[model samples]
Target: MTQITFKQGWRQLISGLADLRLAIILLLSIALFSISGTIIEQGQSVSFYQNNYPEDPAILGFLSWKVILTLGLDHVYTTWWFVTLLVVFGSSLTACSFTRQLPTLKSARRWQYYKRPSQFEKLALSTELSYLTLDQLIPELKQHRYKIFQEGNQLYARKGIMGRIGPIVVHISMLIILVGAIWGAFTGFMAQEMVATGETFQVKNIFEAGKLSKAQIPQDWQVRVNDFWIDYTQEGEIDQFYSDLSVVDLKGNELKQETIHVNQPLRYDGVTFYQTDWGIAAVTVQINNSPIFRLPMAKLNQEGEGNLWGTWVPIKPDLSQGVSLLTRDLKGTLLVYDTAGKLTGVVRPGMGIEVEGITLKVQKLIGSTGLQIKADPGIPIVYTGFGLLMVGVVMSYVSHSQIWALKVDNSLYLGGKTNRAQVGFEQEFLAILTALEKQQPQLVTSSSEKG
Candidate 1:
């Protein structure tokens, strides 16, 4: 009795999980949470959230930085709650497939011959014809491409069985997609890097990483920025930027080289680097017969104007007197400023300007490339699942129709039904009945001689 009760409980659980309404609700909930993830920027520092979502004037009157952090909104995709939702939803799909879709498909494949004339009356379309033979009906069903089965006097035919299998395929595809999403959430990582020209660096500055993402981070190789440059339009506007990058091994051997721009990226060892941004790194200058020096440039916030980079150069050995140099582009134009913040002179590359009894010659401006790198191993599985999903959707559109014919005492009882496309199925059934009617005279003469 205990074993029977346990089995009943298990069956009830499966049946509840297969409910269509429950599946729809879970699907909508997942979509709502995913939208929240997009709205709340994922993978940001605590200071960023504190400044953006202050407690005094919380967004939506309730969402503050404290609330965001407490709920793990900074990295919503890998959150425990989000992962749990995925697992539960996947279980629902699995139960529905086994308890509903699979059983329906199995029932459709099995032969179901109508042995009594009363069964014909229960169908959507049924008819009676005198002196009709199974041999005559077999030819008509074959012409319609229907698979036939006969037992003594009862006959059954069916077509478009793929329509029954389509739902199962769709369920399998959903399960595959869910598995891919969960796997990626636990194994992928994202990082950003700002590399200057002629500089080699390894992957660091990771802002987001899954629990199992350590192995995904590149530790065997490094990347070098060979050069960085930008193209300007005739109107002095920025057109595009390019970065020539090389993949190198530990011993500094070049493994690959490519020029990447906005949409193009470099892929190596399961990690992908995308060109996202650019900036001025530093400027090289010569202090009148002295050794060349590379001074780091910093971006200045100027209202109304675009990006501007500035740096200070000391003309005196004691560093008591200096000049502020600023530029808006890599075209070698430099705006010089005196110690009192007055405009002193405008200098270009290889040109010298006198300041504080010393000459400073402007050299070339160095540029840096901003790259967003990511590693995702589940992308292929997700793509394949989507492909199978499309095939399943197309197959589900075909109608699964079945026909039954029972010859009883010189009269033919015929009936047919379809899972979908009722109007089309009815028309086809009528056409077969008309064909049989046309052969009624020949059938009558043969029946009379046999009697």
Candidate 2:
């Protein structure tokens, strides 16, 4: 007996470990850690921490290279502790659903037609009305949207009973989502590539900084950005930004073409790619020079000057001094100076300038373009989980109300109960009883009538 008791206690302990409350606490802890990871920028450079937090000892200590490496905070989501928390939470939810939810649902579905009026009287929200006959009360109960359960002198009626399953469904959905997320994190790879306009490049790795190795693209798949555009509001706020992309195979066969924007991504081959950002890049300009004409221009913009078109031209014959030519909105103007600290003339792009017997021309401009890339394999599962979660939440919150009616000799009794959403269920119950009394006046005794 003692051995059996020990075994039972152990089983109970194991069962308690898998409870819904434990799952909630585990989920909350994981959420807190995830929030912290986001707030503290994971996988950042050591210098970045040094610059951002020069004096804060806590940040300096925790964000050190050794600490990041030791604690796995550099990649918190994929870390062992984070994954363990998720797995534990998922197991708890699943256990709760199977162990607690199923039995509850079964009990809710069971027919309770033998409950006595004394049992109904014990309920907090029960209603007792003396009526003339069962015939009148039955119709009245049905009018209140209650399904009837009748046995002998007792009748049971229920409405919205399915609502009892909501919380269970919600828990199941959460489990599915967590499972999907875990599946994605372990099995999926993310890759990013920045391509300049009219240029194509293959993505080799995802930027995980120091933690994750570079990602690899499939040999059969290729991605190209056909174009990218950004529209800004009059107030300089971005209104819309999107990228036109084409997917192709190694044989150069086009597989698909799609436009992707923020919040709207493209999916193909079980992979989803998001359009995150775009930036300016690769600027170039051409200049023309001849023997009779000369132009000079700096590659970058001058100090304290806006990006204006300009060229430098040396004065004819002497050639020691030069004139600066400037253009605004295609209109040309000139400023003159010499090499000796004197003011130099501004010049427009494409204009020729002469200095020291040589002619110079403004040739070209160049700059960088930026692009943001992300690929997640688990989005489908996540979305499925979200759908399930919504359904479960709705089911859980809505009440399944049941009313019981019984008749013994000349007396009639009615009682109702709801699993949840009790306030609404009570209102419904009152309305049904009122309708029953109206239709069958004899069943509702004068003493039971409200003032």
C-alpha TM-scores of all predictions: 0.93, 0.74
Error of 1 at 342 (Å): 1.8
* Clashing residue pairs for model 1: none
Instruction: Give stretches of model 1 more than 4 Å off.
Output: 303-305, 354-357, 438-451
Error of 2 at 434 (Å): 3.4
Worst 10 residues of 2 by lDDT: 327-336
lDDT of 2 at 39: 71
RMSD of 1: 3.9
TM-score of 1: 0.93
**Per-residue C-alpha lDDT of model 2 across residues 1-451, encoded as one tens digit per residue:** 9999999997786598667678778978998888867876565667765566454564646555456556766567778899999988877776777777888888889866645657656554655556455666677666666777666777777777668788787887887888777766665565556555555555565654223222323557777777776667898566877778888887767799888888888777766677765543332222234343323333346576744444455545466665454442212233334555465444444554554344545432221124444444566788998999998877776777776667766556666666666677767767766766676675634323221
Model 1: per-residue lDDT, tens digit, 338-451? 888898899998899987667889888999999999998878788888989999999999999999999999898888889999989988988888788788756542111000
Q: Model 2 segments beyond 4 Å from truth? A: 1-10, 43-63, 115-117, 125-131, 209-216, 225-244, 258-368, 439-451
